[model samples]
Target: MRCVIAGGGPAGAMLALLLARAGVEVTLLEKHADFLRDFRGDTIHPSTLRVLDEIGLAEAFHRIPHRKAYGLTLVTDTGASRLADLRGLRGGYDYIAFVPQWDFLNLLTAEAAKYPSFRLLMNAEANGLIRDGGTVRGLRYHDKDGEHELRADLTVAADGRGSTLRVAAGLAPVEMGAPMDVVWFRMPREDGDPGETFLRVSTGRLLVAINRETYWQLGYVIPKGGAERLRAAGIEELRHHVGRLLPFLAERVTLLGSFDDVSVLTVALNRLRRWYRPGFLCIGDAAHAMSPVFGVGINLAVQDAVATANLVLKHGPSAVAAVQRRRMFPTVVTQFAQRVAQKRLIAPALEGSLRLTRVPELARIPVINRLTRTFIGNGVRPEHVASR
Candidate 1:
């Protein structure tokens, strides 16, 4: 069987790799010439780590420059409270690896190249579906030369939340509202800076500080659709907020002289009622756009690819719907958790009403802590690679 997968993000790249390894011809299309996009989801949770281990890429993945975060922490005015401790997990892969997403995708593509059946077309953007009656026959894409059509037995849309192919297939994800959008930027890391990555929360402010060894990748959370208003307030306003949340970066806050230095991620939490239609299938953010609450987006996408591959190999092109059936539970569970967090924690925090100072250390409780660790570290129904 032949498959054409769109968008060489985590889902498309991985599904292509697995299918090709099993001797099926597969082509992966990437709109960009390179995977160097900044502020993309960089958290590779243990569930994905275990998948790499199963695929014999775990050691190589570790070889790349990445930081291992053992736990999640919430920093407030009172003190820092541990949220989830990944080390408590049973699997040898206990920590989330914070690797630049480009490096991670490069690793997957490189390994995929070993199989002659795998074809990766860089700068090839899949724009629409090539339909035969009701079934998707292949894809119509554009490259530097011109637009073209490629025929395959199955067409997969792993293009992401704003997926072009998903739109072409007449699929729309049910919009689950998020209370905040994120402004992502960077500042230089200096001596005496806080080492571990943590979430900083204060009255009317929520910021995420990720340690990138040489620099700090910071995400400032603001009210939904508030990017324009924040810009109106001027760059100095952002600088002041960052300095207040992370006192250590007070001096270098001026590095953000303008808003152009940052990127805004409009947070979304939504999923499709149906992830597949005939020969077409949507996976990853195409099927379910995740909230950035737990950083589980990449891992979930990877899991979807793995499950899709296993089912396709067993049931052929007819397995398209099965992929959704197997993945829907986890998608629902994860998104539900994110929505709850948004309502209880993030929404309140952004509104300057989260009583972090008065609230008990909930993470210290055994059951809630274990559940949080498992939810973040392993995810729901973590899939294993099916034997070829």
Candidate 2:
């Protein structure tokens, strides 16, 4: 069977590698010339590690430089608490590995290059779907040279949240609404700095800091459509806010010299009511755009790729609906949890109500903490790599 996958993000690149390993002919197209973009999804959950181990790349994956967070730490106005103990989870790979996403993608593509059946076309952007009657048969894309067409028995859209192919195929995702957007930037980290990834919450402000060996990837959350106003207030205001919330970073917040250094990520929570057409299938963020609540988006996308490969390799394009059916439960469950957190926790905290204090209080309970860890670490119905 021949397949053409658009977008070389986590889902597209992973599915390509898996299919190529199974000796299937696959062509992967990436719009970007390189995978060196900043602040892409960097969290690699244990569930994804198990997928790598299944494909025999766990040890090699660990060789890449990364920081490990055994659990999530939460600090609020009242006190500090351990939100989830991932170390206690029942798995060989228990900790969340925070590695640069480019490293991860490069590793997958490099391994895929070993198989002659795998073809990667970088700097090629999929412009439209090639349709025969009402079914999609392939895609038309353009690289530095010119426009070109590739025909395949199956087409998969893994292009990300704002997928061009999905729109071209007339698939619209139901908007679930998000309450906040995030400003991401980097700050220096010293040797004795707090090691674990943690969230610091103060009245009317929320900050998430992820340890990145030499620096911290900081995410400052603000109410939806508030980024312009925040910029108007000046970068010094944001620096002062960060300093007031986490005193230790007071000296280094100045590293964010100007608003130019910050990048805005407008969060959205939505999913497609239908994930497939006659000859095409959509997976990953292409089908369901996830809010970055638990940092599980990448892991969920990886699972979708595994399930897609498992079914499609055996049943061909006829298995597309089965892939959607198997994945819908997890997508719905995770998105539901995100919506609840946005409504009850994050939104209230941003509104200065301090309802986020309940998170630490509830997390103190052993069973509640265990259950939270299980849901975050393993997710709902984690898929395993099936033999081709």
Candidate 3:
């Protein structure tokens, strides 16, 4: 457990292999050791799906509990539209699958077993980062071990957007937008296909679907910390919110049952000004936190892992060299896309104008529908197989 990982997420787990395979012993630490049964980070994008295939985890990914998804769904106050039947995209991996992220991580955790050089430490909390002349040299972590300073050739902050390492290192992710958290629940299996998915629009409420399941991944469009008040208003108010959005869910709306607390995530994503400094580096949400809207977070995060691993394999000891080695691909893509996604994708929609007027209009535009289809369709591959 010499190569210290500040987080046990995908980036951290995947990084352990890259370092271990390179003969660097890795220690992965997690705040919460067990995966909770909840709805979170479900969409595995086409780009990321390919990365997993290349990493030799395709079978593991498929074996995880999940449902096959084809494309994105758009639902307005009136109706729904389908995008990119995934079976029809070119030069893009052509399929999107909806596996709960917790399950996916569990699968990766099991597969990390192939490498004995890797050690996973669960329930380990990283209190602060250790630095050397402005470079992060190590981490001070506490678990059953109580408190210990673990030394490593490198320290990676694969922690979440609220990264403790980032804070301790005094690096703030540039605020692109704010976290936009959601409260979501799934319906019991429907008799028929849920029909792609839906993005039902209404005042103070937003309902969306989780691909083909009878269940829909629904949300309320409220500011942060609004879930308790929503729950207090009772199920009837929530039901009323759903009824105005889609009549189809009228009978089934009750089936929404009870919604877990609405977790708020700032939708405004931020990328660290510098991804690495000397003996340390950050990856995944630790480096650049993205909004959940486009469902691109997982894909981008895995790509970060692959890129980091590749660089670590190519270079040794020098995180400077590793970062320099990775300078080309992943960093380039991350840099190139950040501004565009911030300005074009999320900002204009969230802050520029009232989202109410635009959502229905956007869903109705044939061009927009075509764009959604094209985006999702690209996730599918020409061979109709996922990358692996």
Candidate 4:
């Protein structure tokens, strides 16, 4: 194979698809047998929608059972405020699509299967890198049968935040520290429930309620390293917290019988100083683990894949550093914005100091409103599908 990509994520899957479409032999390794993991980053932003349009998959993506969010709303103790209105965005795809990550990945991989040069190895876990002196030859992975080494001209790691291949390549990301972690759980949704997804902020608690049609996939944000304290307080305490946050769900909060119903996400914000080493490159969560502030993780990873495929197909594996150079600015800008929100908004809210009275007015301001819409809708330096 010319290229071997570890991790069948947005980055690796999309890159493999593009390379195969351009007649390059690419093999993609996915440890999981299927893409059915829940509580993952599911927001597909406008920039990604535009890329799908370019690649002729926009209509197909829209076919999936998903919800369209035109704007993000912040509900505080006082009132709800508009964060970013996507209706004013330029592209036809102004709204963000909330589709299950599995559905999205399945769509991409299925499309890639059309190309003869593409190969997907399910249940193949890339455990280490295949090194040839200072360069990476490919990777060593294990499947159900046994351990095997897959050699190729280039190796790309899109494995995720806890990427084993990145560790094998002797690269570490700088930990930038997040102020909060999230406990995710689901509660039943009713006919009269709030329809739009919104972020709710109270004195010392922050919760996000995403309308997942039948159920509300909620994330209760707590202070960093606060999961232990939360569990110690007991599951009923968590039920009380949920009841206090969303009164409509008070009756159903009891459904959370124990901590087993919730998944704790230890938020980490970090990025690799250098994203490539010789024939190896790291992208997506492997390169930068993003905070779930604006829910831009999936979009940014797709953007990285688009940029990587455009460069690599045009200039071959020698363009590895150029991919990082092209993508680093957007990564830095997005992470900086997330860090700012963590410090100014989330941290204070968790500390019972910040108020949202000014947020509504500030969001209405022309300059800030326009910037917020552009930032959330298109992101920084959004990439397009380059024609081969």
Candidate 5:
């Protein structure tokens, strides 16, 4: 079978690699010339590690430079608490690996290149769907040369949250309300700084610091549609806010010299009511745009790719609906958890209510911590690479 996958993000790359390894003809199109974008989802969960292990890439993947985070710590005005202890999980790959996403993608694409059936078109952007009657048969894309069209038995949209092909195919996502947006930037890490990854929450503010060895990848959360106003407050005001929340970073907050350094990620939680059409399917963020609550978006997308490959390689194009059916439950459950956290915890914290007073006590319970870890680390129904 021949397949044309739009977008070379996690889902697209993994799906293409699996199908090609199974001897299916696959062409993967990536709009970007390279995968060196800043602050892309870098959290590699255990579920993804298991997928890599199944495909025999785990050892090589471990060679890449990355930091390991065993758990998350939450600090609030009331007190501090351990959010989830991932180390206690039964899987051998319990820790979350924080590797640069480009390194991860480059590894996948490089391995995929070893297979003759896999074709990667860098800088090629999918412009529209090629339709025969009501079914999508392929796609039309243009690169540096000119417009070109490729025909395939199946078209998979893995183009990300703002997917062009999904829109071209007339698929609309239902937005489930997100209370905040994240401003991501980097700050220097001092030797004396808090070693564990943690979120510091104060009145009207929230900050998450992910250890990147030499620096801390910071996510400053603000109310939805509040980015412009925050910019108006100036960088110094923002710096002061950071200093007030996490006193240790007060000295290095100045590293964010200007607003230009900060990237705004407008958060959204939404999914398509229908994930596929007659000859086409949408997976990953193309089907369900996830809020970056647990940093599980990438893992979930990888899971989607595995499920897609497992079904498609076995049943061909007829398995499209089965892929959706298998993945929909996990998507719904994860999104529901994220929504609840946003409503009960994050939103109120941003609105200046210290609802996190119970976190400290809750963290002491062994069963509660274990359950939280399982939910965050493993997800609902992790898929394996059955195609191999």
Candidate 6:
């Protein structure tokens, strides 16, 4: 079977690698000629970690030199939450690991190359679906060479939240309102790992301190479309918000440099009511896109690839029902992101008496900080990947 995957991102590449290894002909297409430095979905979830182990690519992932997370911490708007330790998983591996999105994509692309059956065609944009009745039969694509078509037994859309293929297939996504957007950038972490969670309530924000090699991914949720205004106000004004978001790290203010191309992304949480139609299936962000909380977006996408590949290899089209059933529970990753959005945005604003009692300044209290950290790793803040 010739399996053609759209989107050279992690999900598409990983799926191609798995199918190719299983003796299937694979064609992977990526629109970008090269991996861009700045991108979204940086952290790799622990569930994804377990999948890597099964696929025999865990060591290769580690070779990428990504930062391992020991635990995560959370704070109220006042920045009161201290560090919560998430290393309680039996036999060591517990906390979520941080890595640059580009590096992680490159790692998967390299691994996909080991399979002789897998062929990658970069700089190719898949424009539409070639259908046999109601089923997708192949793809219509356009590149510098104008246009062409390729046929495959199966088409997997891993193209992401804004998937053109899914849209072309007429799968209208159901959107759950995620009303917040974020500003992302990098900053130097002088000491200790950058895998801490800082949630401050008074300032109305959430911060994910992701540890990279020399810098950390510092994210802050702003009112929808605040990024344009922030940069317009200049770096000093941006720092004011950052300082308010993470008071503990306020001393490290000077170390925080450059916006690194402030990215404005709203909480895009949605799922296609139907993930598969006949011979076509959508995986990763194409099927669902979770909010940024817990870094579940990319992890869920990778998990979808593994699950879809295993199901196809095991049962072929005969297992379509099983495939649909299997994906339902994992949809909770989207639900989980929704829950975080509520905690961070809706519940806080609407919690009448609770909001009054929840002192934003009390986040600086040591015990309060400890309590916040306690809730992060096991339940809320850190990453979760559901293994197949």
Write one digit per residue (lDDT tens) for candidate 2, span 157-207.
Answer: 999999999999899999999999999999999988887789888888998
In model 5, the runs with Cα more than 4 Å from the true position are 355-358, 361-363
| CA deviation > 4 Å runs, candidate 3 | 90-92, 202-205, 212-214, 223-232, 255-268, 320-388
Whole-structure CA lDDT of model 1: 0.93
Name the lDDT value of residue 39 in candidate 1. Answer: 99
Model 5, span 181-200: residue lDDT tens: 99999888889888888888
Q: Return whichever of 1 and 5 wins on lDDT.
A: 1
CA lDDT, candidate 3, residue 98: 82
In candidate 3, how many Å is residue 343 off?
A: 8.1
Candidate 6 per-residue lDDT, tens place, 1-388, comes to 7788999877897788778878788899999897775747767766667667777777877887667666544555433443445554532356577777787778777877887988888899998999999878889888899998989888888888899999988887888756567677766666654344444454344455555657666766666556777777877777776777665467666564666645656677788788877778888788877777656677667766777777888877545455556775667644765677566664454332224234344335567545543433333222222222
Alpha carbon lDDT at 380, candidate 5: 92
Each model's lDDT comes to 0.93, 0.92, 0.63, 0.92, 0.91, 0.69
lDDT score, candidate 2: 0.92
lDDT of 4 by residue, 1-388 (tens): 3999999999899888888889888999999999999899999999999998998999999999999898889988787888777787997788989999999999999999999999999999999988888989999999999999989888999999999999998999999999999999999999999999999999898999999999999999999999999999999999998899899999999999999999999999999999999999999999999999999999899999999899988888888899999999999999999999999989999999986664565467789878998999999999989964
Model 1: residue 190 alpha-carbon error in angstroms: 1.7
For residue 112, give model 4's deviation from the true position in Å. 0.6
Candidate 3 per-residue lDDT over residues 42-83, each given as its tens digit: 677666666666667777787776676665565554455453
* Residue 227 in model 4: lDDT: 98
Decide which is better by lDDT, 3 or 6. 6
Candidate 6: worst-modelled 10 consecutive residues by lDDT: 379-388
lDDT of 6 at 107: 76
Off by over 4 Å in 4: none
**TM-scores of all candidate predictions against the true structure:** 0.98, 0.98, 0.80, 0.98, 0.98, 0.83
lDDT winner, 2 or 3: 2
Q: Model 5, poorest ten-residue lDDT window?
A: 354-363
Candidate 3 contains a number of clashing pairs equal to 21
Instruction: Extract clashing residue pairs from model 5.
Output: none
Candidate 4 pairs with clashing backbones: none
Clashes of each: 0, 0, 21, 0, 0, 11
